[model samples]
Target: MMLIDGKKVSTDLKNELKTRVEELKAKAGCVPGLTVIIVGEDPASQVYVRNKAKSCKETGMNSTVIELPAETSQKELLGKIEALNQDPDVHGILVQQPLPSHIEEYAVTMAIDPSKDVDGFHPENVGQMVLGNLDKCFISCTPFGILELLRRYDIETRGKHCVVVGRSNIVGKPMANLMLQKLRETNCTVTVCHSATQNMPELTRQADILIAAIGRANFITREMVKPGAVVIDVGINRIEDPSRKSGFRLAGDVDFDNVAKMTSAITPVPGGVGPMTIAMLLKNTLQSFARSHNL
Candidate 1:
């Protein structure tokens, strides 16, 4: 079985992006800029934001982090988004997810200007994606990362059967749409499954490519995977493990140990889809900059 080394892939992509940014800078007199807004003190979000900021610095892009109190009002947040939207220097705007319950997540996402919606959560960006527009400013990060991984490995998806086991807007839905686009390399016959999907294993076993984004720990076992299938695990669940130094262990939706034996290729937890998400975010940020400048 081939291990899908997302860490190496992400590193390679980042270096490529850095080189591209250098070329763009020499020609355009500026690099891309990404602005991230964090509403609360969620540890995971904080870590992600920090990593993104570091990536921006390494790539010669400008990045800013806007931190707000947990009790920040909805209107206050919207006001901040509006400011970022009007900032010509800011190519991409992203509001970290799982905003405090009192603050409406959709409202904040909608507040972002479509052109600056690097997270691809805005209705306009999502609509453009549905229409298979390559010129769209952004697509959701995780799904975009999955596609990148497949492409970098020269895995042809055209005419293949792909099963996506999730219905989330952030990953599953967009992933299926992307895979089914009428593109030469990505014209897969895609099936999307969710909580209510019947005979889930039976459906999964038929896939030439299976993506698990269900956010459940070790949910997809060897029985669910077809031999020679390419498995992309997008789930990152933190399970308690006192034996570990951090008192927790990261796992994906697929039971990696067992499923890897059954599949021809598979992504491992922690190092799989996780790193690619950030890489894609950087990619989207650069794309947004290019679009904003009509480059």
Candidate 2:
């Protein structure tokens, strides 16, 4: 089975973006800038934000990170977003998730300008994506990265049965919509299975391409996959592993060891969809930059 190496693919895409950044810099006399507002001291979010800034610098883009206390008020956060929205140098604005319990996530989503909504959670961008107007939308990074992986690996999806095993807005819903669109690289017959889905395995076994995004450890077993199917594992869960130095291991929704034997190709946990998410964030920021300058 062919392993879908997200690390290698992400590196290649970043290198290409680096060159594009140089071209844009030479023409525009400035580089694109991304501003990320992070609230609280969530360890995971901190790591992700650091990686994003590093990637931005690698691509010759400017990165700004605003660290806020856990007790920061919602009004203060929204005001910060508004200020960034008016900042011409900040091409993209992203506020990290899981704010303090008092803060409403939806309000934060609505605060960012649609043009600068690199995370693609704004209602305007979502509307454009739902209408198949991808040119005007910044799709959620994970779903966008999955499509890029399929394209880069030359996987055929036209009219093929694709099963998405989740319903989360970040990955599943957008992925299904992307596959349903009449695009050359997508255009798959999609079936989405969630907690409400009946006979899940029976439905999943019929797919030619399977997307596993359920937030569970090894939820998709060998029996659920069709032979020769292409599997994209989007789940990342930490499971107890006494054998490991960290006493835990990262696993995807699919049982990689058993499921890989059934699929023609599959993505491994930690090195699969994870890396591509950051790469696509960089891409979306770059796109915002290009549009700002009408490039």
Candidate 3:
């Protein structure tokens, strides 16, 4: 089975974005800018925010990270978001997730301006997706990256049976929505399986393209995969491993070792979908800049 190299695809996308940023700077006297706000010091959230900031700089764009304390009040955080919303220099605004227990996510998600909501979590952006107005709103990064991978690989999605195993707003739902769109890069028959799905394997075995985003380690086994089907594993679960210096290893939703034997192509855990998410975020930021500047 051939491996779907997400790292390479993301690198290519970043290079293109870098050039675009240069063109914007030369023509408009400014480059795209992204601002990330992290409420708590969750280790994973911190790492994600740091990487986003670094990527912004690498792509020749302006980057800013606002680190708030765990006890920061909701009003305080919302105030910060409003300030970023009005900042002309900031083309994209993202709030790193998993806030402290006292902070309600719904409020924070709604606070960001839809035009600058690069994370695509705002209802306004989601409404555009529901209406199939793909050009008018930002798509959540993971699903967008999956589509890019399929398009780059010349995967014929038209009329294909694409199964998405997850229902989270972040990945599964958007993925299913995108695959079912009447577009050349999408236009596939989609089936979504969730925790309540009965006879899940029976449904999954019928897929031409299978996407795993259940956030569980090795949840999709070989028995659930169809032979010659293309598998895209979007789950990244950390498992303890004594052999590793970090005392743990990362794994995907599918059992890559066994599932790879059944699928014609598949993506690995760490290198597969992770890099693409960041790449797409940069792309969205660039798009926002282009739209704002009429470029």
Best lDDT goes to which candidate?
Answer: 2
Tell me the lDDT of candidate 1: 0.90
Tens-place lDDT per residue, model 2, 1-295, is 9999999999999999999999999999999999999999999899889999999999999999999999999999999999999999999999998789999999999999999999998989988999999999999999999999999999999999999999988889999999999887799889999999999999999999999999999999999999999999999999999999989999999999999987899999989989999899989999999999999
| lDDT of the candidates, in the order given | 0.90, 0.94, 0.93
Residue pairs of candidate 2 with colliding backbone atoms = none
Clashing pairs in 3: none
For model 3, residues 169-231, the per-residue Cα lDDT tens digits are: 999998899999998878999999999999999999999999999999999998998899999
For model 2, the superposed segments whose C-alpha errors exceed 4 Å read none
Per-candidate TM equals 0.98, 0.99, 0.99
Question: Clash totals for all models, in order?
Answer: 0, 0, 0
Superpose all Cα atoms of candidate 3 onto the true structure and report the RMSD in Å to 1 decimal: 0.7
- State residue 286's C-alpha deviation in candidate 3, in Å: 0.5
What is the C-alpha lDDT profile of model 1 across 1-295, one tens digit per residue?
Answer: 8888999999999999999999888878888999999998999999989999998898889999999999999999999989988988999899998899999878898899988888888888888888998676488989888888998888878899999999999998999999999876579999999999999999999999999999999999989989999999999999999999999999999999888987888899989989999899999998888877777
lDDT of 1 at 48: 88
- State the displacement of the C-alpha of residue 5, model 1, in Å, after optimal TM-score superposition: 1.2
